[model samples]
Target: MIFLLLSIICSVTVGVLLKLAKRYQINVMQAVTWNYLFAIGLSLFFFKPDFSSVSFSLISPVYIALGILLPIIFLFQGFAVRQAGLAKTDIAQRLSLLISLCAAYFIFNENFDRLKYVGIIFGFVAIVLTMYKKQTSSNNKYSWLYLLLVFAGFGVIDILFKLVSQLNEIPYTTALFVIFCISFVLSLAYILYLAIAKKTKIQLINFVCGCILGLFNFGNILFYLKAHRAMAENPSTVFAAMNIGVIIIGSLIGILVFKERLSKWNYTGLVFALIAIVLITLSKLHAV
Candidate 1:
């Protein structure tokens, strides 16, 4: 539980820092690359895992493909955040939980009660509402296409996590290392493209941003792994608490600290999202 909370804090902090990085014109792709590099290194320190333990014979190509998609998602996420702003982008991304839930239901046969249904409904409403854009002289309206893509991309990523978790007896540390390797390779390719195109230069700011991002990125996975481990001990409470708590905390920081704005429709959407969250919480408590 402690780890999960720390992970949530780190996750929110990443969003804040990413937003700040825009001012430095940091190379988000390179930062993402370095983040994976650091994550791989960190996993090694914790797991001291042997390469022999990695059973290539048992691994699925589809599962490995999913791992590769993570960095691509990060690439899209950077654009989404830049274009849509923090609050809207995050709301869209979080709504991808619907995709994960459906995948869990069918693939993992995860069962839920009536309250979960209500929660899903509210979550859907929140997604729509949060995407509502108000025309302002100062700010460009949120792009619906960008929001949709962000949601879909992250939705698939979330489902991939569940799929990978179920596929092998791989330690979480090992799993992360594999994911980092895949993402790092892809990110390197992306950086090379940028360099060749002369779109931007990788400078000290990019490296510094990457270093900071790496710490949070590594912590995010570690804490998320801890959350899952904790869920094994107390499923309903831990899962519900972690998800809703992170969203609430992230949303609060986005709005108050960052002064991210939403239109009237967004407020309504947030209400629904909150209601959905409440339903999930209630369901968990009932199970307890």
Candidate 2:
């Protein structure tokens, strides 16, 4: 429970930092690139994942793909924070569980329980309501397209992580390390592309901000995994708490600290999200 709370805090902090980056007109791409660099180092120092047993043929493809995908989605997340603000972005990210739920039922051959079906229905409604933005004139209206991209990209990422986890021959930590390494290289490629095009130069401020991001980002995953292990008897609890906690805390931060205004419809959508999550957890009650 403690681990889960810490994980939620770290998750919200990542978004907050990205949101704050807007004040300095921080180069989000550069910050994300440095985020990967530092993330790889932290993974090495803390996890020390051994690569000796890695079967490249079986594991390499997935890790390489994740390497590309993670950084890309992270860039989307940065854009969403700046474009959509923290509240909607966080809800969209959490709503990705609905996609994963569908994948699990269709591709993974999981039983489609009644509660989860209702949860799925509620999830769709939640997406529409949470993304509702009243007419505005700041020319800063939330980009629903970007928010949807965040939703789909994260859902795909989660499904891929499930695949990697099922491959018991490869150590989970080792696979994570390889993915981080690949993400680092991919991000660096993007940075170099910018430099060659005379688009922008790397700045120290990016790294300064990125280092803070790296610590909390890594902490989020670390604490989440720990929470799962700690609550192995109730894996569904971890899943529900992690998603719902992020929503509740993230919304509070956005509303209270950032002073982002959410419409009544958006508030209604958050209520629906909670109900959807509860239904999903109820569905898993018997399975675990």
Candidate 3:
């Protein structure tokens, strides 16, 4: 339970940090690039993932896909937080489970209960409502696209992760480490290109911000995995608690601390998101 609490805090903190980045004039791309460096360091220190047994040929495609997607989606998330606010951005991220659910049904041939179906329907509705903005400015309209991309990007990443987990030749930790390394190299290459071609000067503050982001990002994954291990018998509990806790906590912080405005429809969407998650959890429990 304590691990679950810590995981929730760390997850929400990532969004909070992204939100604060704009105020501090942090370069998100540079910060994200450095983030993978610190994440790789932490992964090596803690997981110590063994790669000797891994068949690189067998895992390369999925690994490369994940490596390409991780940093890109992370950047999208940062932009989404800056544009859409933490409350909606978090909800969009969590609702990405809907996409994964569909993939399970079609690609993986997994079955879902009626509750899950209803939940998926509600999840779509929530996405549409939560992304709704009152402003009619072209910039505001364009900004909301980031939220859509966040929703879709995380979904594809989730599906790819599931594919990685299914491969028996590679350990999950090893796969994670490799993906992080790949993301780091790609991000660094892009940053260097910007430096040389666009004359974008890298700053120390961005590195500092990235390191902090890396800590919370790694902490979130560590504690969530620990919580799952701690409650191995009740997997649905961990799933439900993680999603609900983040949505609730992130929304509170966005609205109260940041004073992010939300319409009546958006508030209703939040409630629907909660209900959808509960239903999906119930479906999982029923399957068990």
Clash totals, every prediction: 0, 0, 0
Clashing pairs for predicted structure model 1, backbone only? none
TM-score for each prediction?
0.89, 0.96, 0.97
**What C-alpha root-mean-square deviation, in Å, does candidate 1 show against the real structure?**
2.4
Highest-scoring model, TM-score? 3
Off by over 4 Å in 3: 54-58
Poorly placed runs, candidate 1 (over 4 Å)? 136-142, 284-288
lDDT of 1 at 208: 72
The residue-by-residue lDDT of candidate 3 on 5-69, one tens digit each, is 99999999999999999999999999999999999999999999897866657566988999999
Q: What is the C-alpha RMSD of each candidate to the true structure, in Å?
A: 2.4, 1.5, 1.2
Q: At residue 80, what lDDT does model 3 achieve?
A: 90
Model 2 misplacement above 4 A: 55-58
Residue by residue across 186-231, what tens digits does model 1's lDDT show? 7878788888897767776777788788889778777877787876
Better of 1 and 2 by TM-score: 2
Assess candidate 3 and give its TM-score to the true structure.
Answer: 0.97
Candidate achieving higher lDDT, 1 or 3: 3
